[model samples]
Target: MLEGHALGVHGEGVSIAPVDFSLARGGRLTLLGETGSGKSLIAQAIMGTLPSGLAASGELTIEGQAYAAAEGATRRALWGRRLALLPQEPWHALDPTMASGAQVAESHRYLRGLGRRRAREAARRDLVGLGLGLADAEGSLPGELSGGMAQRVAFAAASAGGAPLVIADEPTKGLDAPRRDAVVRLLAATPQRGGALLTITHDIEVARRLGGEVILLRRGRVVERGPAERLLSAPRSDYAKRLLEAEPSRWPAPPPPPATCGEPVVEARGLAKWRGGRALFRDLALSLRPGEIVGVVGPSGCGKSTLGDLLLGLTGTDAGEVKRAAGHRLAFQKLYQDPPAAFSPHWSLARLLDDLVRRHRLDRTAIAPLMTRLGLDRELLARRPGEISGGELQRFAILRVLLMEPRFLFADEPTSRLDPITQRDTLALLVELARERHCAVMLVSHDPALIERLCDRRLVLGQGEAVLAPESLDAQAV
Candidate 1:
């Protein structure tokens, strides 16, 4: 249903080497690579959405329609009908001004030519099928939904028309195990609809779940391709081998546990948060002790990120109190999930870091050593956040937070956007720094393996409260 022959992307002075591949109707293909390997570029090339000044070469055919020379409406029509993309960043993919339901209904209304009422009904059903309630899905705006909900809404938009070819770019980027499984099932079942599935991702588990074939890319070149199981198990190239080995599942055992947990550095008591008359969580209580790493896990929209915000005093609790031990306010820091949003678009990395250092009266000499330890180049400080890869930006984000020398840290899915290798490295660095400083760390993530490896205790949030689960007791906290 989709084919690319010697397809390449080039701009003013750079180019992505040409690559060749094809997917038959109902077939599945996964493009696997680390950050900066041109995975997204290849997807953009096929979708005919390459940025201005960057041109695509060779040929791209979808549903037997050649797009090399297609123009205007011809290309646009292919998007919602013959081809649809589930973008990497779900929040950005949506139209903030439009109601979520209306945006999703557009696929049915335009591509399938359904009546307004019918399209609305179909969209509601699609949303419900993806685990969202009819009321929440229909009434919420993009801004009103959680990251995971926005992702599901995007999926509904892409698949509503039953497009012949669906291209998903990291569809399960920020979801828990349950939601991830749901997405995997959704894509796996796409073939039964007489369509093809093409996904560009850095997740080995995602690729393995949507099994069929895998194409490995490295530095813009195709290094390997074969059946998913065979390719992953017996990769032919050295890069592919390293990629497989870098999976978090293969990481060595975590470092030895902290010798002794220190006094509570930050504490929350009887916390309650409500949004739009709905309770996110209530009467939540937790404490962060120095030298301890706490993991927060739950299904999406269960208040994990919100809890992080509350702990950091970034958001006010509707009821109850958050208490930081004396002199610990400035010693508290947070690592946001969306690094781009956390930064000002107008500020260069240098300016942002400098401002932080200046405001905190921190020594400038501490900057270079932290950057080196995080595997970040000192040169990156000169570029804006937009100019760097997500992994790099995440590293810098961590660096910026760490520079304050916080005694307690709140990290919300810090490695969600990163590839496995980068994820491992970033986690290792964060843990190391936290240990050296004897800082208390609260890590919010959906990856169970990560929680098990890094956390001394886990907090499971659901149904309006967080239940603390200590590793030693294997018992739930009241």
Candidate 2:
């Protein structure tokens, strides 16, 4: 159903060298790559949504119809009906002002040619099936939903059109194992229905479950192309080998915790949060000490991120008192779940980092070495946040926080977008820096193995409850 000859992307901030490929009807092709490896670029090139500064070239054949890939307008007409691209950042595709159900309903109404009543019914069904409560899903906007919640809503809207050709970019990044499985099933359904499915993801597990063709990319070049099972189990490329090794399960368990943690940096008691008339969590009590690592795990739309917000004072708890130790006001920092939303599109990364350095009177000399350690290309500093891949921008966010030498850091799935190798390394650095700085860390992640490996304690929040697991992280702790 899809074929490309020398199809590639080129632009000011990013570039993907030309390559050739084809996808027959009922076929699935997954793209695996590091952040900024041009994975999303290929999907955008096919969708004809390349940014203004860039353009696509070569030839593309869709549904057996040939056209110049450069002629984006031709592909634009197919959007929402014949083809759909679920973006990496759900915010980019979601209408912030619109209610979640309304957005999905609109797709069904227009693209699927359903009446308002039927469309609304379908939207609610889709949302509920994805584990969202109907009232909560319909009443809330994109900004109010968690990253995983928003992603599921976005998927519903994109797929509501019943488009045969679907291109999903990092669809399962912030989702729990169960939800990830649900989404994988949905993507697999596209091909099972005799339509092609193209996905871009850093998740090796997603690739394994989908059981299809895999294309591993590096710096815009294809390094391996074959069956998913073969490539994942017996990858020929060294980079691919490292990717498999970087899985949280393969990582060695972290060293044992200290005999006694340092004094408390922040403490909260009787914390409670509610959204859209639904209780998220209540009577939650926790404390963070210098050099301590606490992991937060819960299902999508659970109170994991909300708890962070309450602790950071970004949002007030419905019922609670929080105490922050005497320290620099800026010593408490937060790394956002969606890096794009946390940054401004108007400014280059360099300007943003510089402003932070100036505002805090930070050590300017530390920036260069930190960038190198984080695998950030110096050239990326010249580009705006919107110009970089999600993983690269996320690392930049981490870099910004590390520079501040924060007393307490709330990291909301900070490495979700990064490739496995990068995720492993970046997190290791985060832990190392936090310990060196005597900083406390509160990390929220969907991967339990990751939490088990890195944290001294676990907070599992769901259905109006918060359970603090044991410090040793034993099975009973969960």
Candidate 3:
């Protein structure tokens, strides 16, 4: 069994107060809360990554062993062989310069003392088991793989770690529905393999689908504990009730018919594109009118992200004419699907944001309100990129772009790393900005529910082409 009692984790004043909880062996528990309600901190403490200044008191244990009492070497041995953690962003967790297979093999070699050949062989087997195409992806670098693919690589590494306990923090944050389901099933298999899981998530539906026991966390304390179905269906506390109620689909949808006001801010005609041999865009034509938000959705590798890059002129088109309105200030931004590595780990958030502001000659006054809206205070801005949550960094990236006051914006999975409430807040802010500034926003996402909520118009991508939703490609001639 795993347990935490009077677990006060603090630096200066207590950041996380006394909290108590328990998880039976082979049981599953989910910790849910807003962006910075101490959820990540608790996970960090469990993984022994908490800082020196911050001390953890009370008791924490795994199986029959007290985790807090374990010696350094004992703890190190326990980490990968007996316990493992899947951090929020797989790409960030992955070694960008190493081959995926090499990285996965290294995990096995280190944890199990397997030789190079044996580890490589085992790595290939695990990758295939994780629903990845081993041949196509084995030699690829982290940057070469899609977000979903990178996440699967991370999963394969964790599985190879041979841990009996797995702590998955936002494991499905950026994954589409299909990938999410695959991960849920993978977690379900852990118990059958004689393992236990602690899934930290903000999405209730995820908790519902992966039904097991749950411990609902708020402000570093457990507020409710019971069967997942019971608690999500009929919560006793107001916090739990609100969390259960805050489904993405529950939010109001964007107004229909898509406000097609003003001139076109982004234009592309007969845009054809390819990477290696895979065609991403084929004879695609689309236009984004000022003051409108357009959503592009498709399965992974269907070119949704490619279209965004094409729109931003980051990728060249094979055969097409693409144009941005004259003197169009982009204030254009893209919160990378995996944002942690988007900046240097050594650089402070303030340094990055300040560089962006000064380089673009943007007004400095805009920083405070944007940071406030994104739930970041002054203190957080001073920390290094590794110090803050992905949600915060994602928001900071967006704010950095907003300060540029671009005439258009290209956001790819902008809210993928955020908690439910912050997801709503960020999307709402984008929608508000589009309407207020008449900025054309091109949002690339795989979430249908979010598309329905934030998009003014929707496009569905297929094999190298995009078809306007509710308006067939056959009717485009009209």
Name the candidate that leads on lDDT.
2
Model 3 alpha-carbon drift over 4 Å, by segment: 12-14, 69-74, 113-115, 328-331, 470-478
Reference-based lDDT, each prediction: 0.81, 0.90, 0.76
Which ranking of candidates, highest lDDT first?
Answer: 2, 1, 3
Worst 10 residues of 3 by lDDT: 469-478
Per-residue lDDT of 366 in model 3: 85
Q: Candidate 3: count the clashes.
A: 5
Error of model 2, residue 340, in angstroms: 1.0
Q: In candidate 3, list every pair of residues with a backbone clash.
A: 282-464, 329-406, 329-407, 330-406, 331-406
> Taking the tens digit of each residue's C-alpha lDDT, what string does model 3 give over 1-478?
6787776677743377777777776678777777766777777777777654566666678788885621223456678887788877786678889999998999999998999999999999988876676655789887887787788888888778778888888888767788788888888777657778888887677888878887777656667888888988888999887765557778865556454677788899998888657776687888888787878777765677767777788878888988888764544556577676578888788888788778877888988987887777788877877677677788877787778777788888888877777788788887887778878888877677777777766787766667775421221211
Task: Tell me the tens digit of each residue's lDDT in model 2 across 206-280.
Answer: 999987899999998899899999999999999999999999999997898764466799999998888877788
lDDT of 1 by residue, 22-86 (tens): 89977999999877677887888787776555677888777777767223235776777778888
Against the true structure, what is each candidate's TM-score?
A: 0.89, 0.97, 0.92
Error (Å) of candidate 1 at residue 35 is: 1.8
For model 2 the local lDDT of residue 234 reads 97
Write down the TM-score for model 2. 0.97
